[model samples]
Target: MATFIPPGSSNDGADIDLLGKELGLSSGQLREQLNALYARLRLLLTTDELGAWRNESLALFRFSASSSAKATEEYFRVAPRVLDILPPHLFLKWVKRGKALCHDSPGIAAAYFRASPQALATLPERQFNVWLAMGPGLYKRNSESMELAAHFLDAAPALLQVLNLAQLERLLLFLNRLTETDCSLAIRCLDSAYRVFHALEDDERSLFLSIALALVRLKPMASVTFFKQGIDSLAGVTSTQRLRFLTLLAKIAAYNSRHALSFLTDCSHALSGMDRNLHPRLINQCETVLAISAIAGIEFLNNSPAVLASIGPAGLERWYREGLRILRKDEKDGLAYFRLEFPEDGTLERLLVRVELDHVRGVLLMYGEALGGSEIEIRSSDSLADWSLGTIDPGTPATDGTTIFLPSSIDRFDSAEENFTWYKVAVTHQSGHIEFGTFNFCFESKAALFSDSRQLLSADGHGLSDMDRFLGLFDDRRLAADIFSLVEDVRIDYLVQHRYAGIRSGYRFIVQESVWKRPSPVYLPLREAFLEIVIRFSLNGELPFVPEALRGPTDTALRLLQQLRSPEARVEDSAEVAIRLYDLASIIPNTRLPQRDWNAGGSEQARSNRVDTSYRTSDGGDVTIEPGAEVPYQAPTDVDFRGNSNPDMLNIQPTPKDGSDRGTLSPLSSDIGEVQLNSMMQGENLQSGQYTADL
Candidate 1:
């Protein structure tokens, strides 16, 4: 063995001057070059000066090309500089040189061996791992450090068997540190390591696995087992943080249900029997799980008894009740009523309730059928009453009936005190002679003669006041004044003249068929009768009436009535006047004489006093007219007494034997004929002696 020794082998106490022998260069020269390169690279790295470092790396590469055996040495020397410059493209050049020179050149290999570890650490982890796998020269040159390196194990794990406990610990520390920065990078590194590990012999791979597992047990941070520790550590965070963890857990669970469910169970168990303060946080997590389960179409969640139990029956009931209440309120406020025509069947059963008040009043049981051919029959507990209906000739068919009751016979019961009576009315429809049917029931009340003024003036309330207010808007002074006058006159006629006894005076105007003949339908007058009545009554407080001095006021009233009898006058003005008069009559006090004595003549004393009185008697003096038992009178001839009367002109005449005045001729004798005288003369000639008594 001593006869021929390998020159590059480590020999105990042998100093063969290997660098000089192998490279044909002094050791000092190699050391100087290496030192200079190292110095330049260190400066480049520290200062991050790329310009100077590029020139220096190019100069070193030029120096290595001159020596044939120096390629590996040059590669090992330039790699650190290249790493410092971070020229990713040059990694392959250095790797090729490292591979070529790594075999059979001890000094070159030793040079590479000394620099590769530092160069590898300096290079980016990705490129460095690639170089280690492709460049066996770098690996063999730094075989000891490579054996100790986990990063190198990514390329050749078979050599991991050579690493001792301390080397394995160093490998684990580097891997753990690399992973600490980025788990994805660690996964890539571990994946590469796994491929290399599989390439190893079974025994060698087993030894590496044992060391790795032992290192993982001692310090889990270097191993994948630390992921569980990380999850457990995150357990003591806030609800929002917990929610984030749960979301991540759910994503993880999507990929692997077994792992995710295990994690969730652990979290759930940790949450239970712990602080009650975590209830809200735990519940939020549960809700998040439920939402995720729903979105994922997880069948387990839908079929799970736990999820159904969480929502509970009471909560569902509460939600339903709240929805119902909202609906009810909306219905109550949104209800509305409207007016509509009667259908062909003449029924409104399906119409809305509140919107039909006016229609109900006009054609239903609340208001009596005052106008129209529609009848209303009222059925009550006591009795039923039917009201006969009539309508204005030119008016709309009073098929629309209001249901109000009127007594069949309004009996005036003589009671000392007031009496109240009520009657029921049922609204029904009638066509021709047939009764349609009762629709509704209503009641009407009657009161006895009011003894108090308050009862009579109670009309101040109700729609009467509103009607008066409405009439005030018109500015027609003449019409307003006429209305007032007419109302006042009607009131005087009705109350004072003793006309229209026992009848409730009200104003009503109708359009007769004769007035609006062209269209063959009644037309509303230019003005409404009700408005006219309001205006007239408001102006005068009574209807117009004639006076007794002018052949009695009725004759004068009749003359005015006749003047208004024309179609235009009756419809336009008279109708208005009539309505106002009626309204006024209703309000004004009756000053007329009692109906019982209204037509009686004057007393006997009054008649005699009228005959005895002189026509020209002075106000306070009595006239002395001497009474002869039968006084004779004389007619004045053409004395022209039509002129100023003279008290001194007294022409007296004697009385005749018949006591009748001849000058005061009878109106009957003025028409007697001479034939009567001839008949009387012939009879007188025959009975001259019989004419003893002048017959």
Candidate 2:
């Protein structure tokens, strides 16, 4: 059935001699290896299959010889396994394909055989031949692509498992195109394709490959980062938004493929903190800008969230329309407008209802000075000189004992008059802290209204500041600090109300307004609920329905809170009330109450008007905690008007003497110092001469 050429015949011997000379194999060794190949081919192939082998085997060795000895050696090593996996006719086809590659590059031919049964066995004969067709075009582009072509074959099986035929075709086409510009990047994309496509949904994989194809054609170098980070960019967007998001990118790719991926990256960043509901509107806006200029569209989408927050969605529409008009006239200015790089006082400023602090700094500074009876510098809270003073949240009003820091703008209310009043309210509250001696805490001072509890808890006068020393006495310094801040603010509000009759109505209105913003007590953990209840009572003087289990503690906390409202109430009395409140709050578990306590009408009871005024120790043996009821503590929401104040930080700076230069105060001096209190409190190593505060 088969025509066998004996090994030592003139024709066979001459072929072996040619291959041995090319392969550097001795005559005997060449004959032995050739005979072994024949014996194995016979065992693996049928008599009918031997027809192509008779002609192609010697031709394959000659093809390998045309390349190098290495090519010949690789052929011998993988020929058996390849023969075992592929039919004789397919093997003959494969060898002929290798001959084409060897004509241009024997190294690529060697790599071709090295792919062997593993990469070849994954596909049917037709797909395998299609894969071979890719090799020559790839290596023929550049010598460096020889290795890349080999890698593509090796990774073929894994890719087929994750990607369907259509997606595989798109990916291979993309890689092939990329290899023309950068062979190394193409290889990396092939190596990474299995994992990237595996994680994507079937449809998403198709879309991603399509996007990559469109992207690389315009900007081939971007392919390196796009293949590495494109999936991650998509991952940050919500699932519902991904299809629309990808579609938007695809549209951009159609006209402006150069910036399409850049747009995707910027938009994903903008969406991380943004609401998903706004994503549709954001995408729509991007499309509008894209109608103008692709670059402007990308910059606009990046700034959409901040513009929305600063001036609501309505303002954002107007801003975009204005920028669009500018774009028609002058593209550079239009791009600048979308990028928010234009001056604040420019045309965009008119659209905002915000009252910037720089606009009212002089008025507010004089108002603060007149009320506090001292010069107070008005500065932006975000520009505070010392971070050690702690982060004064940028958009809130705060004071560092000397300078009054306010947000860059007050856009809280819609009207200019209302917003200006808001700035006044902020200044008045902070001035009250300075005027009423809130930060002028003395360790030896006595409470004007409540009995002193600091004596029992004091830590032997070891502290950096008197306020720090007083707060350090309690087991939970943060809780004590929060309680003290709450009580002290109540006293400041009372003094401020009585002292400035003109601002009383506006102050009361703000207090009432803030009451609506307070979190409903029913939803909070028990301890946080108590603190919230006190904050509400201090604001509007009305208490909500309390669960019967917490009625006693609620009433007791109410009594301590009421004392801070006394006309003669001092900062010391605030401290005294905080100590009692901390003791009362300590015994109450911070865990969530049962649904029955909040939902069942029978368990809801009104707090008593007449509460026991007697002081109670923290040792409450009467309280019971259910199993698994304990939870981590969370602080209550901050009241807006009463800006954040840290008395310890205030005392860190020494008060300016009558006529001395206030600029020369030591950072670590008594009554004032610029210090990293947060870091120090977190257990950083202290210098030898630094005072140790228990807090």
TM-score of 2: 0.47
Task: Please give the range of 10 consecutive residues that has the lowest summed lDDT in model 2.
Answer: 686-695
Candidate 2 lDDT (Cα, 0 to 1): 0.70
Q: Give me the displacement of residue 379 in model 1, in angstroms.
A: 48
Which candidate's lDDT is highest?
2
lDDT of 1 by residue, 149-249 (tens): 32343333233344333443444453555443454444444545544443434444334344334434444343343232333433443433444444544
Candidate 2 residue-wise lDDT, 1-695, digit = tens:
55554434456456545545544566565557766776666555565555465555556566657546666676767777787778767877887777666666667777777765666776676676676775556664566777877676556667778876557777778988997787888988887787787777777777777778877878887765778787788777777667767777877776566688778788788876677766766777777777778899888888878887878654676787788888888889999999998776645556666677776676566566666766667888777644356555676777866778888876655445556667777888998898888877787788899887788777787645788788778788778778888888888888988776667766777787678667878878888887887888888777776655566666777767776787788888888888888888887778887756653322123442333423222333333434456777876677887878655565566333344554531222232222422222222213421212210
True lDDT of residue 460, candidate 1: 33
Poorly placed runs, candidate 2 (over 4 Å): 1-351, 385-387, 462-464, 599-605, 608-625, 654-660, 663-695
TM-scores for every predicted model? 0.17, 0.47
lDDT of each: 0.31, 0.70
